[model samples]
Target: MSAPTPQPTALTLHQASRVLEVGFDDGAVFRIPFELMRVYSPSAEVQGHGPGQETLQTGKRDVGISQIELVGHYAVQPSFTDGHDTGLFTWGLLYKLGSEQAELWSRYEQRLAEAGVTRDTPMPAKTGGACASH
Candidate 1:
């Protein structure tokens, strides 16, 4: 039989530290930063509809999770302080983010450098797109 999916045993939000701490039944614990979550949100708004369409998030170093709601039994939807509330962070995605934190940071930094922007640079005004509110 196929192995069952890993499940989270505990989930805690440290608002002050801006981190999401997740503990799995397998004894794996990950402390994922809120900034990272915002930058790498799994929503279409950020990921876009296809490859090469991803919107690089900027000035998100201070982003915070305003609220988080459980989605059924497999994920949690977080509402970010920057008015982004569309990404549904699944257990698998969360685990991956936590485990690959360093690599992800490196990639994000590289992308920023390529775009001639810095982590502190504010994103330019969003042009017409799926959501006018962004």
Candidate 2:
């Protein structure tokens, strides 16, 4: 017989730390950062309608999770501080994300490099004096 599906036993969002901690029934636990979750959201806005249309997310280094609402027994919908609340994070997808985080993060970084985008927003150049009229 097949093993029973694993479900999250505990889910905690650390607002100050910007991390989501998930404990599963199968004894697996994950601490996922909010920025990573935002960038890797499973929403169509980020994933697109099909393959080869994935949008690379950037400048989300300080993104935070605003709330998490249970979507029946199968998924949890997370609302981000940036007003993104479309993605329904299924148990399977969450598990996969936790398990393959390292590889996925590496690929994301590579994609950002290729797109010339940084996870951090660029700071404005500082000027010593006030701007002059043109």
Candidate 3:
């Protein structure tokens, strides 16, 4: 007989820490970083609709989860601070991501380097009004 599929028993988003804690029925608990989740989003915007069309996500090193909503009984949709809310993070995918975080993160970094992108660079501050006189 095959083992039963694991399901999430609890999900918590730590905004300050920028981490998502997921506890599974199989006694596995994973703390996934917000940046990792953002870059690895399962949305077509990142993964595309077919093979070899995956887009490399960058500039999300400081991203955070703004919201998490249940999608039926199979998945949760996380709305990112970067305005990404289309990925459906299924239990299976979440488990895989958690289990392979180190390797996946390494690959992501490599891809960013190849693309001449660096997460260390911060976004420029927005300025309003040019030298307004008081």
Cα misplacement distance, residue 3 of candidate 3 (Å): 4.5
lDDT per residue, candidate 2, 1-134, as tens digits?
97666899999999989988889999999988888888889987779777987767777888888789999999999999878899989888788778889998999889878977777854234455332333
lDDT of 3 by residue, 40-81 (tens): 899877786778778777678889888999999899999999
Per-residue alpha-carbon lDDT of candidate 1 for residues 1-134, written as tens digits (9 for 90 to 100): 96776799999999999999999988999999999999999999999888998999999999999899999999999999999999999999998899899999999999999999999999889777564554
Query: Of the candidates numbered 1 and 2, which has the greater TM-score value?
Result: 1
- Candidate 1, which segments miss by more than 4 Å at Cα? 1-3, 130-134
RMSD each, Å:
2.4, 9.4, 8.7
Per-residue lDDT of 80 in model 1: 93
Each candidate's lDDT (Cα)? Answer: 0.93, 0.83, 0.85
Candidate 1 clashing pairs, residues 3+ apart or interchain = none
Candidate with best TM-score: 1
Q: 106, model 3: CA deviation in Å?
A: 1.0
Superposed by TM-score, candidate 3 places the C-alpha of residue 80 at a distance from the truth, in angstroms, of 0.6
TM-score of each: 0.93, 0.85, 0.85
Question: Any runs in candidate 2 off by more than 4 Å, and if so which?
Answer: 1-4, 121-134
Indicate the worst ten consecutive residues by lDDT in candidate 2. 123-132
